[model samples]
Target: MQRLLHSSAPLWASLDKAMLGKLRKKTGYTFSNCKKALEVCGNDIAKAEEWLHEQAKALGWAKANKLEGRATAQGLVGVASDSSCVAMVEVNCETDFVARNKTFRSLVERVAAACLNHGKTLPQDNLTKSFLSADQLKTVPCGKEGGPLADHVALAIGSVGENLSLRRCALLQAPPRSAVHLSGYTHPAENSLGVGPVLCGRYGALVAFKATLDSAPKTQILGRQLCQHIVGMCPERIGDPEKDSPNPDTDSESVLIFQEFLLDVNQTVGNVLEEHDASILDFVRFECGEAC
Candidate 1:
């Protein structure tokens, strides 16, 4: 089974063939299972993986074989937007080095863009759905020719010597005439010990505010400042003092708006917000290991 699955020797002849190596190292399942999986998936490795997972569930193989302790730590994250919406995604990889690679990062960005263009949900089916635009929505193919984002990741994985995965995605929509804004921050490279540390160290925050021409500039400024503050200060919650309590009340360190601004500790977020009457509609914060 292993030989059959990896039959195309010359095609995959290269150093750091981690995918095949991992497959070969997998125990419990016979080589026949691997071969059957590859054949069932028409030689498509990922599809074959999906098939194997299905088989594992149906046959109670994972539990019986006790192979659930495997870890999945490497991956990438992306943020994208179209005229009407914004999307965020986190795609995993086998190693942190690949997670931080420029090629991998670019792929994540493209996937996010595709999600925005298609109105597709996270863990989306039909890669072709990622290609349609609001103005030109149509059914499309599922590979490179059609520009499916998931296929792009798969091809990159095959070429880049690492196991890449699309772990999760999120899309946010705005009503007509409203706008969505996204902000992101990455740790300084000097502070990044290595890929593992960097992946674990990286953090992101995104907020969508609905506003119109009539909206106050002060309100917009407040929101932008809030985002920047989150990046700089690393607040744990939106406004729950108990969740992040050390200094509750006016002295509490957990108050979302009262905490000292990360950019300028001299001013509090609430102090800044006092100048604006805008309301916050929604906000989202993401850390590397947090829930998908």
Candidate 2:
């Protein structure tokens, strides 16, 4: 049985990569073992990877790795929200020219909205399975036919001849009985330049937050202010009192929230936060082309 399992591993692993890579990038031993297991069943990489993920999940190895590498130059950040939910997405492209294209921007907006509407209810693993324009039978001017979000993106990559990726996403959920407040801040330049042009800028930040009706308006305001502060001051952390202060524990200014807040000498986030009654549940910040 051991020899049999070992013999079938490579073929299954190859199949898994072929099938799973279509959906999203995969790595680690779980992906490899999934391929092997699938070969034992019948060279079905899809089935194998699925089964492997399930097994890995059972063994507590299914946690997703947060990829922090520098994003491709071309892309856009999109925000979509309704009363109870909010979603943010980053779609990457190869060049600033293509990133700024109206059609590309429209597509990103539509996909981001779709994710907001369907992401939570859809099967977690197949979030992008739904077709974008199933009935119209229309061809996008960019040499791609209407299809699922992932398919359209892949087509865009081929047509535009640039490496494109959906780098990050955040979805917020509110309690069923509570009214949710959603806020977003994207650098005007970041939105206009998309991913490519912003990469060339010094540094910028995008931050979003969700709070209940009981939450103070100050909290929401602070979040936006914090984002703006990040863009203008470029501090490493929220607590860092000075931008230039040396700290062995942290180096990259972008990730250090305290240091970043300190860079804006005139105003401080802590002082701003003191006035608010709300608590910040979570925040996501992204900087283009910064060292991973």
Candidate 3:
């Protein structure tokens, strides 16, 4: 064999910029991967790029499968909404540290936004859904390029060195022309430093209700109070959680309406609402790592 002259020299020196640029734009692959493909196929752009696509799928599957068994107990609940629409999403990771990471936090926020924009809640969807599989989440696009949400989560897994998953999602909306208004509350996030904003939370609650009043502030306060109550109680039904009530025999305070209001224990939530003529139309509550 002839002596290999300057093997350290660039293997892709003959690969022109125009050809490389085409592959990069087509596959959205990084420069290193594009160059490697060019070198692997001896600068034959077409054949090299095809192989790269095949490798990407295989790599993604392999990477995603590796973390399937890892437990995801630490995460955050993100909520995004307006008066008529609300979306709440819980994304779980392996560690609290990663849960607090900006990328991870951003992933949660984007997922919530995607949930809001995706459309109305399906009739079949109910409280306490399962973890969002990679395929399930991949359908929701996010970020500047609008890549699949699953792709962003995958990146988090790869970069954070932990298994991260979309635990569940809830979407609630009031039909057009309805008197309903939606609101959300996310308990403050706490790091080693201290507590963060209220909406940056480990747990999140969303509530929507119809208001008959012309003065909006009172209804808004009632909406927020309901959301706050949901965060504290997390009841399955307006009446649920039949275990260990303080006076189980006489009263099941577990029922949402019957439960004592957080702000003033003297008044039941139902009584407070009755006094204001405001009713709870819909509610969703999510606490990180807690199952339904």
Q: What are the lDDT scores of the predictions, listed in order? A: 0.49, 0.47, 0.69
RMSD of 3: 7.9
Supply the global lDDT for candidate 1.
0.49
Stretch of 10 with least lDDT, candidate 1: 126-135
| lDDT tens digits by residue: candidate 1, 32-87 | 55555655555666776667645543333323223223454766545554434555
Top TM-score hit:
3
- For every model shown, the clashing-pair count is 7, 20, 1
Cα deviation in Å at residue 65, candidate 1? Answer: 18
Top of the candidates by lDDT? 3
Which run of 10 residues does model 2 get worst, by summed lDDT? 59-68
Give the C-alpha lDDT of model 2. Answer: 0.47
- lDDT string, candidate 3, 1-292, tens digits: 0111123456566778788899889877776677777877888888887767556645544566897788989988887766556777788888999888876786677787776666344342332222344356667766344667776676556556678887777777666556777788888733322211214478888887766766879777778778887897666666422453333532445567777788888987777877877777667788888856
Model 2 spans > 4 angstroms off: 1-72, 120-147, 155-163, 176-181, 189-220, 230-264, 289-292
TM-score of 3: 0.68
Candidate 3: list runs displaced more than 4 Å. 1-62, 120-135, 189-198, 239-252
lDDT of 2 by residue, 182-229 (tens): 445555534433322112122334443333334566546665676666
